[model samples]
Target: QCIIDNVVDLKVQAAITSIVSATLAKAKLLCQDVSARGALVSCPAGYKPTGCACGMGCGSWDIRTDSTCHCQCAGIDWTAARCCKIGV
Candidate 1:
């Protein structure tokens, strides 16, 4: 009976550990996703838009005007800029 109890206790402990580990992994993923979203939202101009249609083709850069950095998108023309479809 003592050995049986010990085995049950070990199984319970293992299950609890698994749950805790899974929860931690989910939390970590959430945090990373939030961080990435924030970075994309606050990115400077000329940096590729996070979800732009043109992908890396839409070169992005930050133009330092006075004391602040302004984000700007780059392309061959207005159509090229439009092609990026930023924020769409």
Candidate 2:
């Protein structure tokens, strides 16, 4: 009885693992870097900004509408955003 239960558990685990692997193989995270010569930059369509960086020694920043990166510093030279999206 114990051996039969162990075998059944093994089979269930295998099935769960295969399902997870198949789902992971079908979906992927695609990322891109966008930069511009100004205080603001935006991710491309269908992409969202995950992080941002600013030039001219500026550290203050924010994301506008979940897409654009805005640097809150005067005389800012550039801004960049790390954008990502999920795709199959």
Candidate 3:
């Protein structure tokens, strides 16, 4: 009886582990698929970047890329003041 109980518990544990592993693998695939699309492109031309890419409703503009004046901070404020520098 003890042996049978132990075997059943082991099998249940294995099954739970397999399910968790499969869920994690599926989540990984989904993330890869999303990232393949790439981050949002610079703010469309003519349209000045509104609301901090940092997500702040409004405040100072955190210049995105140095060359261009676009940014996608993903709502995360920049640690440094400058997002990008102008001129070669």
**TM-score of decoy 2:** 0.72
* Model 1, residue 12: C-alpha shift (Å): 1.3
What candidate 2 gets wrong by more than 4 Å, as runs, is 1-20
Q: Rate the local accuracy (lDDT) of all candidates.
A: 0.35, 0.94, 0.39
Off by over 4 Å in 1: 1-4, 28-88
Report the backbone clash tally of model 1: 8
Candidate 1, which ten residues in sequence have the lowest lDDT sum?
Answer: 30-39
Top candidate when judged by TM-score against the true structure: 2
- For residue 83, what is the lDDT in candidate 2? 99
How accurate locally is residue 78 in candidate 2, as Cα lDDT from 0 to 100?
A: 97
Local accuracy of candidate 2 as per-residue lDDT tens digits, 1-88: 4798889899999999999899989998999999999999999999999999999888899999999999989999999999999997
Report how far off residue 58 is in candidate 3 (Å).
9.5
Global Cα RMSD, each model: 11.2, 4.8, 14.5
Model 2 Cα shift for residue 63 (angstroms):
0.5
Query: In candidate 1, what are the lDDT values of residues 1-88, reduced to their tens digit?
Result: 3798889899999999999888766652111111121112222343332222123344453323322222244422211111121231
Predicted structure 3: lDDT:
0.39
Question: By the TM-score metric, which is better: model 1 or model 2?
Answer: 2
Each prediction's TM-score versus the true structure = 0.27, 0.72, 0.30
